[model samples]
Target: MKKKLGFLALLLVITMLVVSACGSKDEGKSKDSKNASGDEQIELEFWTMQLQPTFTDYINGIIKDFEGENPNIKIKWLDVPAADLSKKILSAVTTNTAPDVVNLNPTFASQLAELDALVNMDEAVSDEDKALYVKGAWEANNINGTTFAIPWYLSTSVTLNNKAIFEEAGLDPEKPATTYEEAAEYAKIIKEKTGKYGYFPSMDLSLVLQHMVMMGADLTNEDGTKAAFNSPEGLYAFEYFTKLYQDGLIPREALTGDQRSTIDMYQAGQVAFFDGSQFIVQVKENAPDLYANTIPSQAITGKSGKKTMSVQNVVVPKQTKHQEAAVKFALFLTNGKNQLEFSKLTPILPSNVEALADPYFTEAGDDAEPTDLVRIVSASQLDSAELLVPPMKNYDELRQAMYDAISASMLGEMTPQEALDQAEQEWNDILAK
Candidate 1:
């Protein structure tokens, strides 16, 4: 009886061991199955700068449509304030939590490219895909021959004139200035006749820089180590602006004022012309009476026939885990059809070449509003619009130095040559370190 009990206990022990092994194997298989299934799904995070409140519906619809077309991929969207984008992106990058894709202006995009934080789209984008965008817009994101981002929306400054003011000044409202010199001449006449300021150049922005580039001043040396704006072309640019200030063609406040001040002047009928993108909408909304007298004209061109183009672009980060999916979504977002749809909702112009060819952009109805005319005129200049400021790591500092020198020259603290030379020296010192 004792031997029989011992055998039964041994059998029970062996049986328990077999059962436990089987359970462990099954659990391992289950875990493997779950992982394999999870691997099939791809999630992407996307960020845009200050596009949320106004474009939430449109963007959400696009996301839904994209998910439907690509069932395996999911996108997580985040809208960041324009002012906080750079800081937010920097923090995300530092933590290795950067979004798969993000929207940024060319300036900020270039800064990241300099840091090697952005993917080189030139290597990833096909030639056929590259040809879809405007040449200038496409090139705007290219730094050191590597394209780091894809162009999305674009704008070029156009001359907006107060027709009533022009007429009162005895200038032909129908024939607006097409060149900077012509603009200056018109400014003199307007101020002389109507006793109102003619126009205020945007000193805070890149207007003066664009003018210099238009006059053939190279922004930097071949290696981008030092300032090249101190050349003869640079001197011409300085002298031109100095002459405008001395002659009182531009408002004195322009040397220090922001775009808001200029817009105020235009709205109050204190100025005849205001050079900007499709800002007529604001004028229409803020002062309907001023809108009635506003006329849109082609942007003032330099001898090069190139207008200053500013581009907003979408980029994929190098740290993204889902590069293929992220790039595909980016291309989808900026495709001709989608870009055209976005343009219809806002006054922005599309960077896609095919979108520009769309009838919506090409045609203006007989009863088109002043804003419509502005859009038409602005769109017409896209072909000739080139980015005046190329992507450089120290661009902001360089621009500030140039602005300071220009300000000094305008204030009579330094001659044009002296101001430019000092600015050039400062720029070289900044780049050296």
Candidate 2:
């Protein structure tokens, strides 16, 4: 009777063990199903800053091509207005639904990198693949030794001269100013002879900042921790820009109005020169006859002969689940062929080294070929392209202070030094906060 009882106990223990093993297997399978679902299909969201109208189809074509090659991957694109992209991106990031891929100003990319929100794309991209772009463009995406973004589109600072104004002012239309001092001289000449301001240098603080940076001034220090706009170079740049207005060379219309009005003055043959990006192509396309005499090329030099321009970039966010795919798509979209095709539709230049080699670059339209100017500016950028100072925590306030000071000084309310002194103090106070 005792032996039979013991045998029953052993049987019960073995049966319980078997049941536990079956449960473990079932649990493991459930967990794997969750992981498999995650791996099989990935939905990606992307944002693009506004480009030329034709660029819409070009970007969509790339999306279609990517979808064809990657059946399991799906992309949803959002076209963000250029003016609102930074604001929207910040809002989305706070909401935890940010786009997997974002197009941003290079300055903003640097800010995102500082925030630890950008992915370190070292494992996602290869050195060989990176070699395809112009030298500094790829470098621009790197912060603290980690590459977080890629260069998708590029435009360089080029001077757009109104040949008609040049001729009307009795200046050589074939040759324009190659230095700021020269441009100013030309402005004065145009104003005197034509009774139209030679150049209405727009009072966009951003443009003022860019040209200051071009003049070999450290807009921000090396550590990215301080403003150097009070340096000698910075003051020199500030003085020159203000002189255009102070000497009554630039019209009040330009100092008070925005880009639209600035261009309107040019179209009306009221200005001799327009300094800006290659997007002058779009402006020319929109009013061909009025701009028939337009000539586009490099920005003029400073006392030191240095040159610079702002750039926008595409960055992969840290929270993206499809990081590898996102990086791959960025590279493919920025490939030489695609950039060349896209630039044709936009005023931006191709950052791809190979893309600019196309014959069309030499003959964009019936307009005068800018081979000499393009070569000079492109060459300068290869060695000296620098991103503008990233927007800081108090960037808005700081910019406002600077703008008010500069504008006040330009309006003869204060001298340049006095304005800069006040600006420096105000900026330093903000830094303290």
Candidate 3:
């Protein structure tokens, strides 16, 4: 009887052990299922202009660091060619595959901002964050009081001189023309002395026109109801380009050449003085010896003596799912340290004033003086810069037409006034449509 009781207890112990093992397996299964409720990793898409080989490492390194810190989020970069940006972005948006963030021209930002395709960053950005950019920059991204983008980088038309050309013409190589008249006189001298094109009126008329508009033309008036381009101010700009071309200060090629070709001419030293982007730092880096003479440009004096600058902005697309992350990234990219890094790699100015004080400029080498030139250009953004025309709905088409008309006039197919008058009618009609 004792032996039988002992056997029963042993059987009970074995059964209990089997039950405990089963319970442990169930808990393991439960924990494995809980992964469904774990934090969902998010992915974001960002787009930027084409970068040269020199800047590839800097950009990729920044992105890699950001990803390391935020492993929960993944970033996919879409680099679009600067020339095909509009078409590519628009196609992507139209097809419902747009990037979460886009680095775009302020002109296009205004147009997209107008279409309600960008998120209003006003509520997302704090007053302190808002203070990061120069006064009118954020305002430039706002259309009708709605902020759609944040200023990313600043660019303005600045004069670049070939020191050799200046010396040959008996002009001061160190002191570039402070006024348009002075620039024109130097241009005249350059043409006569060297037989090279003295200057290239910006191939893009919008740049020159915007400066004229800011100087007081007001293409669209204060009321925003009337067109002002037919006024004396408008005609003044028309005459400026006409005079430059007709006076032989600029070559006939410039009348139809775009910014790329114009810059190419300047880099080749074929043009003595050229209006180019403020971002000469990257240019200097690319061709160290050639860019030795580049400097921060000031506004060419219009008959009115006013100066103006232009800015490019970063925008958050309306269709993005990662709005907060995109905003954070945009701010990070444009903040003091990063903006300075970008400015060093590219010729674009940092939108942040604090960045202007950074050692990148202070510790720059002789070969890197253009970095300081960029810093000076960045500092002038607040005092001298103004918004380009608010993006218009049919902007690309309208701009092409305007350029065509102006080019036709330059080719002697029409007069400047006639081209502008037709442009006014065409633009107003497009707006009405």
Per-prediction TM-score to the true structure, in the order listed: 0.90, 0.81, 0.79
How many times do residue backbones clash in model 2? Answer: 0
Residues 55-145 of candidate 3: C-alpha lDDT, one tens digit per residue: 6777787788787876666677777778777667665554445687888877666655665668898987889999988766777777777
Backbone clash tally (model 3): 2
| Global fold similarity of model 1 (TM-score) | 0.90
Judged by lDDT, which candidate is best? Answer: 1
Between candidates 2 and 3, the one scoring higher on TM-score is 2
Model 3 CA deviation exceeding 4 Å by range: 1-40, 52-56, 67-71, 83-85, 223-225, 277-290, 293-299, 303-310, 359-371, 374-378, 413-415
User: Backbone collision count in every prediction?
Assistant: 0, 0, 2
Q: Roughly what TM-score does model 3 have, to 2 decimal places?
A: 0.79
**Candidate 3 lDDT:** 0.67
Model 2: per-residue Cα lDDT over 74-157, one tens digit each: 778889778777667765554445677888866566556656667776656787887777666766677667676787766556
lDDT of 1 by residue, 1-433 (tens): 1223323433443454344444533231111112345656777889998997899998998899999998778888999988778767765664456788999888877767766778899988889999999999999898888899999998888888899998898889899988878888998898899889887777876666787888788878888887888888889888888988988888887887888888888888898887855577789999998898888899876666778888999999876766788899999999998999999888889999999999887788988888888778889888788888888765666777889998889888999999999998988987886
Runs in model 2 lying further than 4 Å from the true structure: 1-39, 51-53, 142-146, 276-279, 282-286, 362-385, 388-393
lDDT of 3 at 411: 65
Comparison by TM-score, 1 against 3, better one:
1
